[model samples]
Target: MTTRVRDERGSAAIEAAIGLPAFVLFVGMIIAGGRLAIAHQSVQAAAADAARAASISRDARTADATARREAEASLANQQIDCRSTRVSVSTAAFRVPVGQAADVTVTVSCRLDLSDLSVPGIPGSRVVRATMSSPIDTWRERAARGFRIPDAYADVWGQS
Candidate 1:
């Protein structure tokens, strides 16, 4: 007598054992991607705020300070706790002659840690960068300020 073969016995359990881990891993990845995306948006907004703050300033000296402060504040407000952060501001536009179009550019970079996921081949953290520019008002008149300018930028004002 030939023995009958079973087609369905233990199949569901076996399949689940193999598939559940994959499904859970997939969901973890989705959540990680979403967190990264939100971080990107937050950094981008921080850059924009930095640029805006810089652009409204009367000179490069003040612009750099304002941009840095704004960018830091924005990141904090967004609840982004970056492992490291760097901010760069270009204030050359402030040197342009009055009545000409110019802009301030701000770039922000932040490293976000994702090591908790332990995804294979993925680094412990990823760096995100965002750059934004804001137009400076051509009609705004800048006044010489009593505040001491940083030595690094003193040459810009013809100061020895």
Candidate 2:
């Protein structure tokens, strides 16, 4: 009877040891998935802000600068897992010099700011990116009304 009781206790201990790890693994995955979803939304918002900034500018250079600032600012304000961001604008006008009627393509990228979250079991630092485009012709007109764009677009001044 003493030997049987000892064996039962050992079996229970072994089962607990195994079960604990599996339970922890499941919970960690759920948390990581939630973090990923938040990061994705932040990236999408940054991208949309960048595109809006670009569309309000008259030329590719101005659009790029405005979009970049907007993307960075958006990410900063959101304060999500997005630690770094870059934005760029490419013109679809197929012209040597981007002009008022140019269609601008905006791209925004963001990545996890956590350093050395180096554990493989946790969320791998992720990069989320998005792109959008809009025409600048209407923006040029709006500017004529003395309506200045936001501060992020300040770099685009006088470049129609």
lDDT of 1 by residue, 4-96 (tens): 987898999999999999999898789788878999999999999999999888888999999999999999999998899999998888667
Give the poorly placed runs of model 1, Cα more than 4 Å off.
1-7, 116-123, 143-160
Model 2 agreement with the true structure over 1-160: per-residue lDDT tens digits: 3554444658878998999999987886677677667777877888888887877775556666888888888877887645566666675542423254656677777767434232354434667788877666633443322445567777787533
Please give the CA lDDT of all the candidate structures: 0.88, 0.67
Off by over 4 Å in 2: 1-10, 81-83, 93-102, 113-124, 135-160
TM-scores vs. true structure, each candidate: 0.82, 0.64
Q: Give all candidate RMSDs, comma-separated.
A: 7.3, 9.5
> In candidate 2, residue 11 scores what lDDT?
82
Per TM-score, the best of the predicted structures is 1
Clashing pairs in model 2, backbone N/Cα/C closer than 3 A:
none
